[model samples]
Target: MQDPLPQIVDSHCHLDFDDLAADLPDVVARATAAGVTRMVTICTRLRNAAHVRAIAETHGPVFWAAGTHPMSVADEPMATLDELEKLARHPKFVGIGETGLDYHYTAETKALQQDSLRLHIEAARRTGLPLIIHARDADDDMARILTEEYRAGPYSCVMHCFSSSAELARAALDLGFYLSMSGIAAFPKSAELRAIFAAAPLERILLETDSPYLAPPPHRGKRNEPAYTAHTARVGAEVFGLDYADFAAATSTNFDRLFWKAAAWAKAA
Candidate 1:
């Protein structure tokens, strides 16, 4: 018989989004069959928190986090520390954000995005949950604000779907934060990006699909799901020059370390 696949977690995904949510049972089943035993579904808008939380509440292997997306910062009501803190109280809530600056398309919202990010950081600090960051063209500011807030009071974080500069990677690593590997790291031409991860400590890495988006090769250009986390893990194993089982073990341990609530929940179960 074939050996069972190594277990790994899809540390970030969007199960509340319509594409995946429409067929939630199937998406989750596929993820389980792929050896992705758990997933964190992010709520990008405060208004959708109820829906996002519901998905986690109903799904056994799913947990969740919430914050405003940078692009939506300009139009959506700013997220409050109290609001985010309340959300963090949920049994299934395990992280602070898919939050941080994104200047690529929404440079206009820079100031507001920064403010929102700080608020989320405060929530993470008060709640002691990991902060999930979505950084894009604003690496410099992203690095700066995270450093500034971290100095004020340390908090756990992960640079989710990391495809930024090596400098930013080092900055995040220096602060003892994690860099999550997503489908982007598996692209044929992402050598530079992979090298960034390769240089970072394996103990500080996580795997994600950023699903319904950035599906890795073979599934490239298609909708991503938690199952695709295994594909990214395959590439991560190659980048680290370790066997897939070893790489999966390291990332899974890293996930539990950074996402301690999820770890505690699993232990309690």
Candidate 2:
């Protein structure tokens, strides 16, 4: 008989997004079949929180997080601290954001994004949930703000889909934050990024798909899903010089550690 695939977690995805929502059942099923036993669906806009929460409520293996994405700060209403704290009340709500500065495309709204990011950080602090960051092209400010806030009061965080500089990675790691590996890390040209991960402590690493986007090779240029987490994870195994099973277990344990609510929920189940 064949051995069972090692269990892993897709620590970030967007199941409520149209690309995946249109066939959510099958997407989740494929993830399960591929040994991706858990997923965290992120709500990028506050207005879509219901839909995102619904996806988690309906899917046994799914959990969720909500925040205003930095790029969308201009379009969406600023997410208030009270609002994020209320969302954290949900039984399956596991984290505070896919939030942080994204000056790459939205540099024009940097001021508002900064304000919003701080608000989300406050929520993460008050709620005792991990802050899920999505930084891009705003490393200096990102690093500064994160350090400033941590000084004020510490909060756990994960740099979701981390593809930033080694300096920023060091800044986060120095603060004792987790760095999540996404499909970007599996790309042929992501050698530098992989090296960054390899240099970081294995205990601080996690895996994600960032799905409906950045599908790893073989599925590159195609829509990504939770199942593709295994692809990036295989690459993570290679980067860390461990067998796939060891890598999967380590990342999943990291996920459970950083996402304690999800871990508690699983234990209760």
Candidate 3:
């Protein structure tokens, strides 16, 4: 029998990482059982691109994006426009980066991170794929660079696992980019973050796990997987004052819009 639960999409996750990769089959199964029909597993290091792409190839429900993560920018060889565009050639390759500034920890590599981010932005622009951003403690530069880059030439993007300030939220939203709700938004102390999401238009909202990281309540402090996206979605529904099904449908639609390649791949499949 089909799942009676509403369909959900985990717009960002790290299934390539050891935490979930060790038991990926069961993880994917649990996500399916929980009404998560699709997931985009992010490749944070270009060196791991093949392994990440293989997971997407083998899993019917999985799609992927690749880039050098800001935190890893100094360590990894900087990603190039050609390499990112080449990766996008794969049918299930749907987005760019899990990339952006991460000043909280990697502040020393800020210059290199900015350079890598611009390369990814160019790749996103060239490939017509959504740029998946990860911002932390550098909202001013993020807002500035994104606005500057967008003005240079418009490109689609989503602030993945967004927990930034209202100003940054407004910056992204004003540029017509989406803000993804992650497990962090469901945390009890995240009322301010929830309010940032609440003030945004529902159509501009997406959902994610960023799993192997921020698991929502009940599972907080435990390892997260795609299945827990539903938990975060429920929180999103409450913030938006919509029923679960409606919120799920809206986010699924938002995912389709932002990750059109994945949506198209599903249709072809």
Please give the CA lDDT of all the candidate structures. Answer: 0.94, 0.96, 0.96
Which ranges in model 3 have alpha carbons more than 4 Å from their true place? 1-3
Per-candidate TM-score against the hidden true structure: 0.98, 0.99, 0.98
Across 1-269, the per-residue lDDT of candidate 1 in tens digits comes to: 99998999999999988879889999999999999999999999999999999999899999999989888998899888889988989998999987999899999889999998999999999999999999989989999999999999999999999999999999999999999999999999999999999999999999999999999999999899999999999999999999999999999999999999999999898
Q: How would you encode candidate 3's per-residue C-alpha lDDT over 1-269 as one tens digit per residue?
A: 95579999999999989999899999999999999999999999999999999999999999999998999988899888889989999999999998999999989999999998999999999999999999999999999999999999999999999999999999999999999999999999999999999999999999999999999998999999999999999999999999999999999999999999999999898
Candidate 1 residue 114 Cα shift, in angstroms, is 0.7
For model 2, which pairs clash?
none
Weakest ten-residue segment in model 2 by summed lDDT = 77-86
Give residue 140's lDDT in candidate 2 (0 to 100).
98
In angstroms, the error of model 3 at 207 is: 0.5
Residue clash pairs of candidate 3: none
lDDT of 3: 0.96
lDDT of 2 at 220: 100
Query: How big is the positional error of residue 190 in model 1, measured in Å on the Cα after superposition?
Result: 0.3
